[model samples]
Target chain A: MATYPRDLQYTREHEWARIEDDVIRVGITAYAVEQLGDVTLVDMPAPGEDVQAHERFGDIESVKTVSELFAPVSGEVVDVNTDLESSPELVNEGPYEDGWLVTIRPSDQAELDGLMDAAKYEEYLGTLDG
Target chain B: MSEALRETSLTDEHRALGARLVPFAGWRMPVQYEGIKKEHEAVRTRAGLFDVSHMGEILVEGPQAVAAVDRLVTNDVSKLTTGKALYTACCNEQGHILDDLIVYRLEDEKVLVVCNASNRDKIVGHFAQNLSLGTPWNDVSDAWALLALQGPHALATMKDLGAPPSLLELPYFSVTRASLGGVDLWAARTGYTGEDGFEFFCASEDAVALWRALIEAGTCHGLQPVGLGARDTLRLEARLMLYGNDITEETHPLEAGLGWVVKLDAGDFIGRDALRAIKGAGLGRKLVGFEMTGRGIARHGYPIVANGEPVGEVTSGSPGPTVGRNIGLGYVPLALAKVGTTLGIEIRGKVVDAMVVRTPFYKR
Candidate 1:
């Protein structure tokens, strides 16, 4: 019953990316929030930092555990979410919209094609339930 | 890997209630229902129910029960009257804690020992080795389920759930036999949260019925089901020592601020000589409560630094829900353990400012 928008491409690590022009807007999926319970802190990388695909960018800490955030595509960080510094719960409330984690200017735009679309991601998530 | 996690009797009930399950101490238990913060607040202001069935229970009965238990723990249990419970710890020959537990003297010859779920087998084995032959002891963990109803509204909630006046009138650290909605059980006025609450022990078969009945009765009083996530924060805020995290086999009771429970004059226990020797030799390091003065949540295994050198390590740390501050406990040099002593916690490779503060950060 978790929502997966058709406009966003997904990573196996549960990050979602929406490509606009040459930049990809990134955020964690709603399913990740459900799995994390309540997020207490979000450690985001600074803007202008270069990130490689499938590498750890930062960490998200819940009350019980901490999870590493992985970059879904290779890119230079264009912008980071400043709003999360005060209200980490935004990731639980509006993970897709207002809780967008970062904006990345793609180093190679071809990486978007390698990611899974909404239908494919939803199917991938179903396999995890088993 | 997925099949390794063990489930409690209420696993199905927790799933039905939309609880987010997490693996804790080898058991797949509910970490939160709606959310941790909300459930934590409910326990402070109203009432909260917790499925502590993971806690292990052992029953010891015989003429020598008191003497047998007295010889194992640091505290003297011989003076405990029937229906009263005392908190104590079992220790190794070196006087280091093996596990902290609560022993309830149900009768003159019968005592119930409650221990952490993770140390169930170890503690039972420890007892088996020391207990004299012909002394009857049984591990009743699998036969019973434990539930905690905690908060200011807990007493009223129990009353509404058909608990007898006798059970309701029982003072703290006291136990009484009672019937809740026709289910016979033992209710003890003891809880981990620093609140007026009661812990109920009933047969495993009656767990579902008892839980639902309490929930249905507590609905009007604002009772929510709490998970182990909040349980940790609640206990930390109250300065209660968690066996594995806060107190361990390497740490002695005196340095952990639990010297009060260790009775040196009470005579011949397993760790008496070692504890006596420790009392004579001044402590090198002491576990002290601290508050984060800078921005960061200091977590377990974080180093406590002083003068750019590692002094000690953090045992437990979290954002205290009631206090609205980031608080933690850690071991520090005896000089640095005093209140107002400034220390640093190395969090994520950066040192964060922290100060040693008075304990029980959220006292009622």
Candidate 2:
């Protein structure tokens, strides 16, 4: 069974968002990391770049395949995880704590309500199994 | 399409250990146990076990066995002594490759030929047609099971299992019969991982027992059961040629960078004349390795470009486990195949910079 934190919001594409004041911490879900075996490389967006919600922001390359990282909330990228360049496996090791991908300051705080909660995301994943 | 996927003798054992099963070459095989990189590291640093029964084996025995096999393969089979194995390719009359196989000379009159499982029927049909004039051939793939024990610590693991001293002295590409845990078996010092390892051949019924015995013996030395996903990554890291991916019917040995394996000066074989001509005229495009210099991953069928013109396409690509970088193999013009040449790979409508590098992308 996959674990989901009740405090975080999730997107349909398996990205997680945790809002802190005006900034939001984003990373991939545990299910996403399990799907992509071992991570080898991470392509991060620039710190100053503006990204749209549900749009491709970067790429994550695993030993078996490559997957695009999508932004869970619309915001300006304030900071990108530079540690992932040399230690990409951390995403697989700690998807919630140390594996955070980026911090973004959303233009509107109301966008958080549009994302799915833990219970809803778990239910969404159940539909995919069938 | 509803036909059930074939299972190896170790299928239940693999599932018991929590392996992810996937369909490979029409068989339900393990893709990974813990993880590909972790299992690959275990094989590089320690030892790893592999269930390789999916490979096909054929038996050839008769008065004209040597002559019959020599006419069908590209290698000099007549020079092989007993208990020796030679890697070679079988070609058609039109100089196209049928399949690459390993020929084991068990005795002066008997030989064992191992081929890819997907091409078993085709190879058997070709053998029957070409060697029908003499030599009796039979398919023995169903009766035998193949297992690989590979790594740097393989010898120690074998010794711990009470293997005979003679087994330790077997040189590379040599085979000998030995007993392990009271079971008689044929052990060959051959492998595809470019490491010092042994391949064990035994009866199909005895496979599960042998696997359990080895795993029990290897427990203290960090031996784990590996899957086909790690097998492919390891072979690619060693730059070993895979038939359907690196070499195919449309590609010749020379073009696939396997010219050293072809013995053209040793007299006439099936494709000797065409290979001789190819050797003399030189090759046009050659297989080469490359590492990504940009952000994106290069995948199979991605267009390769040099100086704004398309040169070739990637045949195999992945983010290598050991190298910690994106690497791939592709066919490029002969001149650009040299190491350090800059190239480009188109990824998602954008060109990503790449550079040609020497193969065996990862070295321990």
Candidate 3:
């Protein structure tokens, strides 16, 4: 299990949500990146697209397999890290930094309460070992 | 219900190397050690060792051995002298592929047929039920282990392992018996990856010593222990046909672009008549190599569209790290199998742009 940033919230799907000003930045966790092998392509919703909490917003493809990118909070896609389109390896290089997928403007700020904190996310990940 | 996975002779070695093991062909096999790209690059650039012990090997002992196997596969095995190997597709009477295999001529009265681990039983059954001769054949999979050392530095690593002084003179697709670390084994200058290499065959009990010796000898040469992950990508780049994906009981060698191995006029064989008929009727659909000219990657089972109509399906696709492009192999109508034909691979409901190109996607 990889250590999650304390301030960010996490989802069972291994996505992370970081509150940046009024928008929530989203990216997959390091644990997910490790499982995906080499990142080849990252597809995400463009700006202004609406995303619902726990819904699939896009896709991430790696050399080994492909995975769905889920929304941690219901909101409109304010921006997508288009840099990932040409250099998807950024995700494997650093899933938290240059690899961040999208930024979403939360429709309901309270929705963040339902997401797991770092400690809670670690606990949730531990259950997956079974 | 799923049965327990089988273990190869070097299961402990893979585990000790911290390889990621997964169930493949009813066996717990290593998928990769560090990563696919890194391991794949290592083999393409330097050298790498692979534990192919899970691959099945069947031996035939009798004067009719080579002749017996020639009738089962598409290649002309009678042309193979002792210490030579040839690749061909084993097909049913209907010309449907059973498996792609390598037949090694060990002696005048002994030959070895190496097939995919998953197709071991089926291939054995095909040979037994189809052959009328008294040539004795045995499934020697459990009794043997295979290791491949591949790349430009492969022969150098072999020399370091004290393989044989004459190994430098070995020709491709040639096999010879030798002893290393007091272990009796036979080696062939053959490999799956498109590179110069050798595949060593030894007893299952001797796999450990051979592995350790090769590793020690390969250390200075930067030989990494590769798993099936890199091996798959490497072979795909080499445009090598993967049995279940590229050629199956549903596909034939002619359509798979393996007609070179089909010696229709050579002699009578299992699917000779059917193959002749197929070759005469002309190909409705044939396999071709393609590259993603646009966004997205093609994968196995993806629908292929041409002129806005679904025309075929992708058989194997991946990022060719060596070629530095997204590449794949798929079946398409004969009219659309030309070198410059444009095709669409329906990936995730969207048809992505692809174009047929020359094959053997990578070469040394």
TM-score of each model, paired residue for residue: 0.96, 0.92, 0.98
Worst 10 residues of 2 chain B by lDDT: B259-268
Which residue ranges in model 2 land beyond 4 Å of their true spot? Answer: A106-114, A127-130, B1-3, B293-296, B323-325, B361-364
lDDT-sorted candidate list, best first: 1, 3, 2
Report the C-alpha lDDT of model 3 over A1-130, residue by residue, as the tens digit.
Answer: 4668998899999999999999999999988987788899988988999999999999998876789999999999999999998899999888899999999999999999999999999998888873
Write the candidate numbers in order of decreasing DockQ.
3, 2, 1
Residues B36-99, model 2: lDDT tens digits? 9989988999999999998999889986787788788888888889889989988876566889
lDDT, residue B274, model 1: 93
Model 1: how far residue A87 lies from native, Å? 1.0
True contacts kept of 2: 0.86
Model 3 chain B: lowest-lDDT 10 consecutive positions: B160-169
Q: Which pairs clash in model 2?
A: none
lDDT of 2: 0.87
Off by more than 4 A, model 1: B1-5
Candidate 2 TM-score, C-alpha based? 0.92
Native contacts retained per candidate? 0.50, 0.86, 0.64
Cα lDDT of all candidates, in order?
A: 0.91, 0.87, 0.90
Residue pairs clashing in model 1 are: none
Instruction: Give a tens-digit lDDT track for model 1, residues B188-232.
Output: 999999888999899999998889898988989999999998999
